[model samples]
Target: MNGYGSRGSTPGQGRGFRPRGGVGRRPYPQDAQEAQAARPRKLSCPPELRDAFVEARDFLAGLIAALGLPARLGFGGVDPARDGRQITIEVRSLADAPDRPDERGPDGRQEPGDLAILIGKHGATLDALSALTNAFMHRNNSRDLFFSVDVEGYRARRVATLRSIAQRCATRVLREGIALELEPMPPSERRIIHLSLAANADLQTESIGVGSQRRIVIMPRDSAPPVEPLEDFE
Candidate 1:
């Protein structure tokens, strides 16, 4: 008599075998509910700020219309820094019409294009428009406010990309025991990188260089030398 059956048998393949619980199974209903509840609420402007927000939004809308761009503007809300001194207003563009004939360039020559002309090379035109808007707001109001203009969510997506790069650089710094330098970026983008790694205790971040050459450097926390203790003459 053969000791083993013709079919090869695994320990768990017997007729009474029972699979382990929670293996290859979806999360429990309570777990899913808790995760949904943990999500953060959307940012909203304070009651006091609503009037100012509306004013700014209307001003921008009028400006856009005056430029002859067929786009609608919407306010995303104010993001106030923890220090309360800085606030950024998000402006989203809703392009609803076909491209119009290009408007005259600064030199009186007809430039061929549509509202996209506003989003110049790397958004230079948009930046210029934002600067003008900010100046207008300051001149008309008692409060000195800073403004950032975002066209079609460009800034939001850029921020997300910067955060991903920051994370990758941080991981490299922690694993390789060496410092890594990121390409020079504008102040707003640099802030994103700094915030992304702010919670990582194992990594230290610093911005070096000046002006456009400035960039972020990530190094291991232990890379810095210990401070020497001062001697007491007495």
Candidate 2:
């Protein structure tokens, strides 16, 4: 006859609508479960946000030490809380220049070639450094954080280089009737080409292949685009 009595039985209660005490029982409705199920999962940042670029800087740190390079260096993380989701963690090293050196560039730039060993061999070494840093950050972060790592501003410079290449490729596609295929590049690099040529009406861009083989292709515009052709390209 307690609270459960009189009418029909309530959920998890006897016909009298009575409450029960047990090892794993709750009196309230399963509100938490219902709320959790109703909520949607969201990513903190887009795949290309600065927070996610970790593949470059970490490798440089290890490579410099192993190859016996200059030791003056500085590394840190930057979480500006950009927007609600994105966070940028910048790790840098100045092998030639002391981090807090009294003498600084007239323009306030870090000393040059401080981490030359890190940017070795046509950026092969630099690329490795970026990859290693990303791997490390991913392991240490509480949640799956995405960030880009730069060694001596390599990523920034690379972005400019990629944009130039994208423009040239787009031009070639417009001039020639054939499609232009670029060398394989990272996903971020491919995105750069896509964005750079997004406004091109005469030519369109698309990415193809998987993993290491993935690359961007620029093709002439067509009325009915081909299955994998970019935008209006056929």
TM-scores, one per candidate: 0.55, 0.51
Q: How far does residue 124 in candidate 1 sit from its true spot (Å)?
A: 5.7
lDDT of model number 2: 0.45
Task: lDDT for model 1, please.
Answer: 0.50
lDDT of 2 by residue, 1-234 (tens): 000101000011101111123234223232233223212122233345433333333344455567655442232233455433323322333322333555433333344544544554324554565566556666866444434333444444455555655665566566656676666667767787898988878877778899877877778877333332222110
- Per-residue lDDT, model 1, residue 232, is 10
Instruction: Please tell me which predicted candidate would have the highest lDDT against the true structure.
Output: 1
lDDT against the true structure, per candidate, is: 0.50, 0.45
lDDT tens per residue, model 1, 9-65? 000100111122323422212222222322212445556665665566567667777
- Relative to the unseen true structure, what is the C-alpha lDDT of residue 188 in candidate 1, on a scale of 0 to 100? 67
How does residue 42 of candidate 1 score in lDDT?
40
lDDT at position 179, candidate 1:
75
